[model samples]
Target chain A: MISAYVTLAVLLLGLALWRQTQPDPGHRQIAAGGWRQMRPLLVRIPIALIAGSFLAMLVPRELVASSLGDGSGLQGILLATLLGAVMPGGPMITFPIALALISAGTGTAQMVTLITAWSVLALHRVIAFELPALGWRLTGIRLLACLILAPIAGLLAMLIGAART
Target chain B: MAGQTGGKPARNGPPLLDGSTVFFVLLALGAGLAVLLLRGADAFNTALADGLGLLLLIMPIVVAAVLVGAYVQAMVPREAMERWLGGSSGMRGLLLATAAGSLTPGGPFAAFPLVLALYRSGAAVPVCVTYLTSWSVLGINRALVWELPLLGPEFTLTRLLVSLPLPLIAGLLTRGLLHRFSRTVT
Candidate 1:
């Protein structure tokens, strides 16, 4: 994980630098904009993760494993997907909770479904961003198309042994 | 348009940290405080330390992710989006939109408005749906910067591979609906 993280940073930094060489006015904006994004994140992500980690310890492992565990099977995946979709906020919020769940003995399939649900069907994103941007018709259309993604991804994870995370 | 782009518009509306940010902070603080009180300080410390460990693992990657987000925003030809993502351009256009949505960084704030602009400028419903579906499913920036680090490569790869067909499927389904609805209207 550390190696992968380092490699990504180095590679992305290279890309940002290469982009900077183009002399476009937007180049300077990248660093400045990046700092702006990071400011809130540096504060928010830690708070979320720190709280989540402790919360995970408090959650009974047996309970979590029983519900979202491999033993729970398809039912667990469905529950996870539903939970994830209804849960608000972006990746910073979701990922930390997910990490806590993983530490709490949640199965890979359930986690996969959870994250997929968050990405595709998150109520907040749809209500806040999608509706305002694309209107009801388009929003409904996209939602309909995405309705099956999470459950199917769960099933696929089971079939392909992606449950090993 | 969100009034965010095309030269910073007047700051007449609410700030970014109004409702959502406050709620999240309250939730976190409440949770942290609850665990500390119930579990005692030692357990609370342990939990935070564990979180710190995980945070350390992913901090650099997260930083890089933010930078990538900014770079993608800086570089995209947001104004010309309609030219490529719009009209009766067919499959090529759909593919371009999908690629842009998945590969392009930034959060909903960046992607949705650009998509809405394209739609307003005459992008087909199918094309727009394809773009949104791709962004949700593929989500390259989040997957790379967050998922890989937090969830690791295996789960991420598996999800990515399984989800590979989603955008095209969504496009086709949406296109089918569009045609059927138009037929009904006619």
Candidate 2:
């Protein structure tokens, strides 16, 4: 974790240096914009974390282990994919829930499927953004084309995990 | 498309205290109450401390991610990206779209419009599909900001490796579907 922080800090410094080299440096505006984007996330993050912690406690570990843990296999992946597709909101919500689930002993492959499905097949996003922006034809085609990807990713992760062990 | 803002706050941008935030706050409160009542004070305190501890651990990383996302947004030449994607087709087009998608920062609001613009400007269907797939699946900004921090390196790396080929496969499948549909229409 300390190493992660150091690496990120170094990357941030490099980005700052790069920004300075630009001819029309709009550092102030960029900083303000970033703050604007981040403000909402700041509010959400703590609450989400607290909620996740409580959830991790409340949820039965035996259930999580039996359903989504190692050896859960295709059934777990499929269930995760379905849950992910229906999950609303953004990374703030999704990641916290994922963390909670992980804490409760959900398998790595299951979480992979869940995140991938949320990213790729989120029904809310498709309806709220994609359909309005890209219309039915493009959205429908894209949805169809990418429908199976989350499960495939989960299966692959499962295979890799099996191989490693 | 050239003058369009990539990550700038739109005129009608969401309020700081939006519906989602309110909902989450309520949910968190409810959960806290439940923990206090059912699990007792000790459990509640423990959970709260754990949450705060995790928050402290990841806060710096999150800040860095936000800064990186912001700077990358400022730096990306949106017009250049549009031009490159607009002029390409076939496998090369899919590759370019994938790169653009991964590199394109911001959320659905920023990305969906770009894909829409590309589609309207005559970028092929497959290319558009690939771009959106890449944005949704392989987004570098999201990986750095959320996935790596939350999921850790091992899970992040494994998921990434498995997801690497997804956009291309989706593009190819889309192209095939389009071909079949077009033939039937004709």
Candidate 3:
């Protein structure tokens, strides 16, 4: 995850520098425009990740695993996905957390569910990024989509996990 | 045209690129580096080095998505997007978008940049929503990698069943609400 951030930063910086040195005024304008468009996400995503990391660490991995771990059934999958929606972190923290849960003997299904929820329905991204740019209606719809799909995605992941096992 | 090449109305909106943008890129990079240091430089370095490999893995899909986005942007007009795929009666559009999303190739990370380009190219809200949702949920690649290898065939089938309708559901609900609001105002 950290690597991803570094990668993104370097890419963005390269893009900016390229923009700065553009010979065409219009090209510079375009590059500058892309940069502006990306600003909020660039700023807020890190903050979300930071806050998410702390929150992820605070939650007991054992507790999470137990409640929505490997032994957890379909119901558990649903619960785990719901839990994921509330846990706002990046792939870095979430992936590690999920791996820990799996290692702890949590159901692989639960891991998938958790990841689906985390990636799709994170409240931090919703509040800080989506709502402001896309407007309430759009954000609300996205939230609805995420919440509605999370369980299904979890269920699918679990079923696949189960079959493999 | 979504402020495309020729939308320069002078007062269209704010200028692109600024100090804030630079700061954000710098900050994100700094934070990422910090994360690497905390985790262990050797492990982090190796992982970071693999980022390009990952990028290469999804390059084809990204290129396809970009072409699709550009085509959609060039061809789809605001009136058309609104009429067939806009807010209220845009159910078909939503479904189409969801289907397109389900078919998108590659991993989520690889797809992000291409999707961002789509968003920039005046793609509809529901379409973007569906695309993002379906990209992760029902990618063929995941079926091969994570689903088949780890989860087995039955579970993979079940997972697909569950994920199939998500993009549609998301797209419809989002479009429905937006349409409703738009109607209320007019």
Candidate 4:
């Protein structure tokens, strides 16, 4: 069902792209301007990936799965979020590891926080591209917001899970 | 065609080769091989087995993101996205910001281009903040891929239940702070 929604959304967005690409100058101008502005970040992503991959090698998955594994609560969430920020895996690695951690019996709340931080506050991304592009004020503000919200989201996911079952 | 002379690359093109694609390809291969050698074929096999599905899932997402990125490039004028689900009333603005925030895709990086488009097209500071704050916390993308698989149906449902409201809270608080800051400037 969710996948269907995503498929639908992607298809709609694709159609939107096709429509926008028509002979209108406004859309073309927007695309051109966007490319000019975002070039720096595009240049930065591969560096971040290399760095993230290397870092992923150092932190053994067992430690991550154990320390913040299924049983841990708010504390685990806190730890996992920070760890996720610093540890430096993209969604490709993080998503599966998150599942593995859950299967290993990590708390749902903790997983929620960890995943939230992983996606939003990835240390590699923050350092390599985000801070530079958005600036310290906005970057700091967003990180602070994520820090506060991730735990709550984690808790909410857990609570929701509990209610459903 | 008219602006074809701009020569600048498309912002949404494949990102793999941006900084150092060739190097990373080698790195990914090296890393994979290291696991194969040190941990033997079994360890390499396990990592791939565990990791492959997510990589597959994200492929479509990344493709879609790039395409939406192109559309966002062309259409969806920025002002519209930031148009606050509500007007001036701070609380109302906050609620609207939150709802709007949840729907945008990509992380901060993805939002970067979109937000720039918004600002260029005439978005407010508070609305931008709300949208950005929402992008990080809410996982419309992950909610589709990671959350469903990892958390199971019950947990996935619960997360959507909880996450749906977060942008509102975050957006409101962010707007209030930015509003206060702007007011002081004025």
Candidate 5:
């Protein structure tokens, strides 16, 4: 974690320096914008962490492991995909739950499927944003195009995991 | 078109307290209550401490990520990219859209408008799908800020490697599907 912070700090410094070199002269605005973004994160992260931790405790380890464990295979991946698509909210909400599940012994492949499905096929995002913005034709096309990706990714992850172990 | 773009304010930054935040707070409270009831005060305290400890550990990384995201967004040549996206096609267009999607910062609100704008300006359906797919599956901002810190590097790397080809594949698939659909319709 400390290493992650250091790396990010160096990267942030580099980006800040690059901004300084830019002609826009809106470094102050950028900083303000960052803070504006951070405020919501600040409010949500702790609560999410709490929720995740509590969830981790409440959810039976045996249940998680049995359903989404390494041995669960394609069935687990499919279930995870469904879970991911229906899961509500953004990363702040999703990541914590993911972490909690990880702690509770969810398999790597299943988690990968879940995250990929959530990112690509999130029903809420499609309904709330894509349909309204892009209209049905494009939305339908994109959905049909990308529908198979999450499961494929999950299966591949499982293969890689198998190869590794 | 101008009105369509102008009417929806670009929600680059989320509001401080939105519906999601309220929902999360309620979820946390309910979970906390459940823990307290099911186990006891001891377990409740432990869970709280664990959550707070995790928060403190990741806080600096999160802060750095937020700044990096903001600075990168500020620095992106949006108009130049739009111009590039507007006048490209074929495999090159798909590649460009994929790159743009991966690089695009912020949530759906910021991305969808740009995609819609690009689509309106005659970007190919495959290209648009590629861009949106790339944005959805491989966004650098989300990966850096959320995935790396929360999920750890191994999972992130594995997931990314598996997903790297997805946007292009989706683009190509969309191309084929659209062609067949057009033929059927005609």
Candidate 6:
């Protein structure tokens, strides 16, 4: 599935690149801009990989399985959301940890809630990016409005999980 | 495409790799070392190899996505984009901003600054909120490329369907609140 996803992304990107290259100005600018942004990956990628690996190894699998496993139910959703918000790092870190929990018997709803919480209220993103760029008022209101989203998502997924059984 | 801001980089008061990154890295290292000491090197090596495999898998996607993102961004410079998003009002602006946020694929560094640019140029509070919320929730590229592959299609769809209403609701509420705040202050 991942391979298919990657292939699709690459194909679409190829089409976009081709379209951009059609115009001479875009051709010149796109290459330079892409390189500039992609350059940091030289450093960030390795660090991220190492961090992700270590985080995966360190995650308390027993606790995760027990707290977010099939039997955990509604309370599990809240716990997962809270964990997502506080868990540090980007997708490189989060996804692996989520995957580990899944393998350890955590429910799909718990993982969904976890990722949703991470996406909307990630402490790392807020500290590293949002606070400085968007500021207190914008961040605060956004957070407030987003308060119920993870739980809502969790509930929906849980309903689905229940229906399937 | 992540760090492509204009002029001074949104002065955010702190350096890019602040204490957060260092602190987290240290934490990972400490935990990993303990795991190694207790669980032995085989478990440690296996975990690292898994991370390496994942990195390899996503490397091509990441580069291609970045290039595509840069092209999209180039096609709509901040000045032009900000003008459009800021001038547009009501549901249309909200929808457009949400679409932009959903379609736009880049890391946090690129997005936060861009939204700030829109806000600084007079985009409505609701539009900005919508944009951020949509970006966080929908993140189409991330979901399709990363989540779908990692978690499978079913899981991805479940989450998306559940999160569908988030941006619009957040936007409407934020707009109303902002209007009330300004009206009262004046």
Q: List the residue pairs that clash in candidate 1.
A: none
Which segments of candidate 4 are over 4 A away from where they belong? A1-62, A87-93, A96-105, A128-130, B1-16, B20-27, B46-79, B82-89, B106-110, B113-125, B139-158, B175-186
Look at candidate 2 and give me any clashing residue pairs: none
Off by over 4 Å in 3: A1-65, A157-165, B1-92, B99-125, B135-162, B175-186
Tens digits of per-residue lDDT for model 4 on A1-165? 356446547665665667756766554565465454334433333333333333344346776666776556667877876866775645545554455556555666676677666765677877877677767876676666555666777777667656757
**In terms of DockQ, which candidate is strongest?**
5
Name every residue pair that clashes in candidate 5: none
Task: Tell me the tens digit of each residue's lDDT in model 3 across B1-186.
Answer: 123244323332343333443444454356456646666666455444433343344333322223233223223333443333233325666676655555554334444554455556666767778767776666653443333322334444565676677888777766676677688632
Under CAPRI classification, how is model 1 graded? medium
Pick out the ten consecutive residues of candidate 1 chain A with the lowest summed lDDT: A37-46
List DockQ for all candidates: 0.53, 0.59, 0.13, 0.25, 0.63, 0.48
Interface RMSD of 1: 3.7
lDDT, residue A95, candidate 2: 83
Candidate 6 residue lDDT tens string, A1-165: 565456557766675766756654555577688777665444455455666566666668788778898778889999988998998877756765676567667888888899999998998889889998888998988888777788888988898888988
What digit string (tens of lDDT, one per residue) describes model 3 on residues A1-165? 233234334544554465456444443445344344333333333333333332333346677667876676877877877778887534333443443354455665666676567657777656765665566655666777567577777766666666866
- Model 6 segments more than 4 A misplaced: A2-14, A17-29, A89-93, A124-136, A159-165, B1-28, B105-109, B140-161, B176-186
The i-RMS of every model, in angstroms, reads 3.7, 3.2, 11.7, 7.2, 3.7, 4.0
Q: Candidate 6 residues B1-186, lDDT tens each?
A: 345445534335343344545565675677678769988999888877876787776666666655655666666665655665776767888878777787766779768888888888777788888888889989875775456545666788889888887788888878767776678632
Task: Write the residue-wise lDDT of candidate 2 on A73-129 in tens digits.
Answer: 899999999999999988878887898899999999999999999999999999899
In angstroms, give how far residue B34 of model 6 lies from its true place: 1.8
- Give the Å error, residue B117, model 2: 1.5
Model 4 chain B poorest ten-residue lDDT run: B1-10
Q: Report, for every candidate in turn, its global Cα lDDT versus the true structure.
A: 0.76, 0.84, 0.53, 0.57, 0.85, 0.74
Candidate 5 lDDT over residue span A36-108, tens digit each? 7777677777788889899888988998999999889899999999999999889978998999899999999
**Stretch of 10 with least lDDT, candidate 2 chain B:** B1-10
The candidates, ranked best first by DockQ, are 5, 2, 1, 6, 4, 3
Stronger candidate by DockQ (3 vs 6): 6
